[model samples]
Target: MGLWDDLKMQYRMGGITQRLIFWNIGVFLVSLIFYEFRLGTFIFPDWLALSSDPLVLAIHPWTLLTYAFLHSGFLHLLFNMLVLNYAGMLFLTFFKEKQLVGLYILSAIFSGIIFCGAYFLMGRVSIIVGASAAIMAILVAATTYSPHMPIRLLLIGRVQLWHMTAVILIIDLMQLMIENTGGHISHLAGAFFGFTYIKLLQTGTDLSKIVTGTVDGVLRMFKPSQPKPFKKVHRNYNTQPRSTTASKTAVKDKKQQQIDEILDKISRSGYDSLTQQEKDFLFNAGK
Candidate 1:
């Protein structure tokens, strides 16, 4: 397969985390059209990027979550996606993809609100855009859930999950008074939200349900209603060979059984547990 076909196959086999990464990258590419070369920054419209002004936010509140899909630069997008992929996969190991999706969206809004509030208090007007906030939430959430989880790092040997999270948080804290203060504030806000999410989840209260429910509700609104089925009527199938029909049914059942087995393996041991052959089979089945 060509590169595009290869990527499409990969996307089909991968889970929600891979889809999320693709979305961020897709958004970044589209956003390049609005880049202001002269200013060395993207000049997104007020409705797109989160503004510190309360009035602006009131006019376009959706920017809170929308901003998280945007990035300031190529490196900014790259760094966030790398961390997101790592943390998101770790998160999926323990939580459902639905919860991860909700956490990402909710945390971005929480972080954006905090960032806007901070800037408003400082009497500064500015716009912020990046997935760092949501990415931080995923990373911190995973770490909170599995602080003792061992991770192997290049040239650093194995380290506890919390060690990595602490270093990142410390860097953000130290940079609070330095440059990109708004970005740092948002990152910290997202981290706090992540930690809080895990705590509430442990208490048997899942906050992610709110976002997921809202999303489902909105989707239902746009969903095309299915047509009611007519009354069943018996039809002669002797026109086609009985053996051909039986053979097709057997093939279909076999394919479905294989699919079910692969899915069960994924559920029990995570997607990474699948062998290359199984991955290829799943991808081809999807096609």
Candidate 2:
């Protein structure tokens, strides 16, 4: 009904990818407003932007993550967000929302660490900004998960996943010698995380679980505790409904069987072959 109400609804229903984009854009706009009002750039960005100096990073460890949501310029923000939207949609097609969040955060952190290391070696202190590292992770993660998947590139027609990755790698590699060497290195670091994330997953290990658990633990700390309701002092002898272990086993077996069947279908006909209901079932099971 209203702007705030519409935003709440969108946040409630929108996928994690869209929410991440919104957050980045919101921060970028706020930064711009502050700049426009002669607030000067030194105040906000200096606190949040990732720095190559180990001393600065040690003092403000949170900058490793905060920098991913900041941008130095409008074009910088636009390019990164565009890539994020594109890659995020592709990544979400086959992975859970939690996985996306984990990969993004982890990759950005890895990138920041590597960037800091590079600059430290060069004996220089440079503040890094932008979401390029995180966006690279999303793009590479999707490409790793489904290397054969087709994507339409302008003037290039339909191209395979590896092709896109190769081109990106080449561009990043080339740019390393030209300018922003740390940024290019960070992109490569993020790409490494994306590739490894899928490889480890294929071996039945999920890094997302760790990220999810940590998030839940922190959320619990901030969440207000609800008061307990009054309970009856007297006990009744009425029997409760019986839920047999056998029935529970049967239910679990059925769900697993369905999941197996859906996965088999995907392997044979690709992810697009599944019906809407089947897709939702698989997605929920992932959660």
Candidate 3:
């Protein structure tokens, strides 16, 4: 297949991680068209970037999440996308794709709020843009869930997940007071949110649901209403006998029972435990 065709295929088949990366890269490219390259840096407008001033944020509230999709430079976009791909994939292995998306969005907003609050308290004004906060949240959330999971690194061999997470957190901590303090603060805020997310999840509280539910509600509000298909009522003189209808009902009940058994098995031991015959049956039933 051609390059564009291949990318479309991948997008159709791949999970949320791939889609998120696509969105970040797509935004970066679109931003380039309007970006003014001054002093070898891409300067985004205040409407797009998250500003520390409460008034600016109040006026441009969307920046809390929009800023996460933006980057100040090519290298900034490249590194964040790389980390997002890695961390998002790891997160998916343990959680649903919806949860991963919800976490990414919620974390970015949480971090942005913290960034603004910190800056406001210090009586300083600044603007920030990048997906580092969201990406860091994904990485740390995955690490929190499976800290003992082994990961192999080039030249460094296999290490536990927490080890990798700690290194990143330590680096952020070390840089907290030095350069780019606001960015580092946002990163740490995202990390904190990630850690909290996993903990609350363990206690049977899914924080991601808030974001997921809000988005779903908003979509429902804006989605066009579909007209119901008109059905004409007809009296059939040649109706099936009662015995035949009862037999069909029995057969349908039997099929539903089998489906329930397969679903229960999947919930207990996962879909991989199902036999090929059972898999085919389920797939056909779904269709």
Candidate 4:
């Protein structure tokens, strides 16, 4: 296969996070191509910026959603995509695919709103573009969901996921006070959404449901309908009863039943009530 075809195949087979990164990279490259050829610029213009201009922002409101797919430079795209891949995989472990897509789009839009709000207040008039805000949202979500989850640093030993998230937030806060204040503000918005999303989920209110429905609707349009076929049954003239593997199976079943009872007790009285051996078992099982 050709290089382009291979890339397409890889992208199609990639997970949600990878697919998003591919889309952002593809858009960024297209923008670069246009810029290099001196053709019509693919970058969104300032007039399309979501600022105080109510009419413009209303008519082209889709830009708020699309802007996250556009990136300025290679380094910018690389960092954002890397974070997205890591966080997105973690997010899928607990969330449904539809919820993941919904959260991503919502995070992107909220990030744009914060970006424009900051620009307007700070007297900066420039079009905002990039997936950094959305990526930050995913990062916050993953770290918050698994705060004690260990992650290895290059030179340093392992640290809790929450620590990494805190460092990122601190840096972004400091940056907001210095350069690219609007961008940092956008990061804050994404972080807020991520944090709040987890909180709300704990309380049983999931905002991702709306996005899930929309995605399901779109997918249903392309699905083909198939009729059920009749099944045929044959009678056996001579049948023998199968004997149960009692000896070996009984031992395994007893172990599983004991584990289930322990889990049920923990659910009833909380993990603190679990004995040291039970705690060790749980930890090792998780690993």
List model 4 lDDT by residue over 1-287, tens digit each: 34564455446435576678788887777666444322433444533333434455667888788778776566667878888878887787778766677788999898887776766676666566777788788778877788898888789889998998999999998888778766788888999999888889889998888788777888999888788988989887744433345665787788678778777875466445766677555444434
lDDT of 1 at 253: 100
Q: What lDDT would each prediction earn against the true structure? A: 0.90, 0.83, 0.89, 0.73
Q: Which stretches of candidate 2 lie over 4 Å from their true place?
A: 2-4, 33-44, 224-287
Q: Model 1 off-target regions past 4 Å?
A: 38-40, 233-246, 253-284
In candidate 2, residue 124 scores what lDDT? Answer: 84
Model 1 lDDT at residue 63? 95
Alpha-carbon TM-score of each model against the true structure:
0.86, 0.74, 0.79, 0.70
Q: Cα deviation of 179 in candidate 2 (Å)?
A: 0.9
Indicate the residue-level lDDT of 131 in model 4. 78
Q: Supply the TM-score for candidate 2.
A: 0.74
- Candidate numbers, best lDDT first, in rank order: 1, 3, 2, 4
Report each candidate's C-alpha RMSD, comma-separated, in the order given: 3.3, 8.4, 6.9, 10.9
Comparing 1 and 3 on TM-score, the stronger one: 1
Q: Which candidate has the highest TM-score of all? A: 1
Residue pairs in candidate 3 whose N, alpha carbon or C atoms collide under 3 angstroms: none
Clashes of 2: 0
lDDT tens per residue, model 1, 19-71: 89999999888877766654565667778889999999999999998899998
lDDT of 2 by residue, 1-287 (tens): 34564455445445687799889989877766544223333234456888887777889999999889888776777888888978998998898999999988888898999999888888888888888998898898889889899989999999998898889999999999699888899999999988888999999998878789899999999999999999869877756445675687889999999999987886567555767678667666765
* Candidate structures ordered by TM-score, highest first: 1, 3, 2, 4
